[model samples]
Target: MEDKTEEKKVISIEDRIPKLKEERKKKANRRLIFYLTIFFILIACVVYLQSPYSNVKEITVTGNDVVPIEEIKELSGIDDETNIWMLQKRIAKKDIEGHPLIESMTIKRSLPQTVKITVTEFNIIGYTEEKGKYYPVLVDGSVLKDYPMSYRGDRPFILNFDEQAYMEMIATQLNELPEHVLRLISEVSWEPTKNNKNKILLYMNDGFIVDATLRDFSDKMKNYPSIIAQLDPKEKGIVHMGVGIYFEKIKKK
Candidate 1:
């Protein structure tokens, strides 16, 4: 009878009901915590948006020269009443760069209540005179007509360059020349000969004059320092760089 006996084991749903209930409770509790966190975050955002602390309280401007600080600030279209979080960086940049002198600009947010603006102005290469007033010339060969004033002689003066196209070419050439060569030039005049339409006269600060054509002007001027070094410093004369390089002495009166 013992050899023939068999045993059976079974589990009922009631035995597993408590474990399933515990697992479901844990999942529901986690879901509830997640919802509460999201709800609190949304409420905090709304409160912050309505608070006065989110408004811009300080504005800073830097890297500007010809354009006045006050004028740049006014052009930015931003003020203390603007919300720091709602600032339109592109709009502000466009408005500020609309000025002729402003080449580019950048806007940055410095946290809680500060906005900063930086600008880069065009490089002032020289000045052109019109009606006894001097206007600044930029590297791009544009003259600032609205900024006419007295000449300080800090930069070279462009004289008798009525043709805009020629002036632009000359500006490009000057930009290509080395800084040392540029500083030595006090004045540039359009002195065309019957045979040469591009002839130009450069009045040097060191009392010497340079005669050359606009074509290859930058390349030729590179050797000017070496040429001047070989000449008698006390004897001022015209250094001809066209056709052949030679020095014609200015006879003492």
Candidate 2:
């Protein structure tokens, strides 16, 4: 009877505690994984909504003319109140491209916070006079914009020529003008009054005039100060600085 009681007391772990504990552990691990997955899903959704593409907070302008900043924004539909993330570069480019005055533009971003605009201005070749009104000419020599009578009177300019044609000839030369000559020039009329082709009048501040043909204009205009040095500054006369630097100085009548 004692031997029979000892065999019964020796219970097998397979029939009880070990199996139960393993089942419990599997259930607990599944629960933990479920909770972790839910947590990460919530985090990913939040991140996606708050990313750079969803919003815009700042707008900046650089390399611009003071006159066009506000106007450009209006035309571009890029309002001060608009979000940066909403800006589309292609759309913006299309908007401003209509304005002939604007040469080029580039847009950039600052993370999720800001947008920047960079601009390059049109090249001005000469100036135009219409019914005593004056306007700056673009590189193509077209009238950039109109001006009033106050702009007229003794400005040197390339005389009447097609705006587009003149730009190719005169734009580079205008850029190369010396600081002294540049300052002294009152106007640049395309196609002069006398046999207008290939000729321009550069009116000087020192009461002299330069009849400069477009050919070798940069070189001719470069020597203008020395040309002015020999002239009588007080007299109202024309100094021909167009071809080979000739100064026909005449006293005021």
Against the true structure, whose lDDT is highest?
1
lDDT of 2 by residue, 1-253 (tens): 9987776666664467878998999999999999999999989867856664546555676777533577677666775455565677898877766566677888887876677777776755455667666676655445655322234333346455565666667766776776556667776556545665777776656656667777677787787777667766665566565434555657445
- Compared with the true structure, what per-residue lDDT tens digits does model 1 show for residues 78-164? 888899999988888888888888999999999989999999998777889888888988887789899785776666898888888
Clashes of each: 0, 20
Q: What is the lDDT of residue 62 in candidate 2?
A: 71
Number of colliding residue pairs in model 1: 0
**Which ten-residue region of model 1 has the weakest summed lDDT?**
2-11
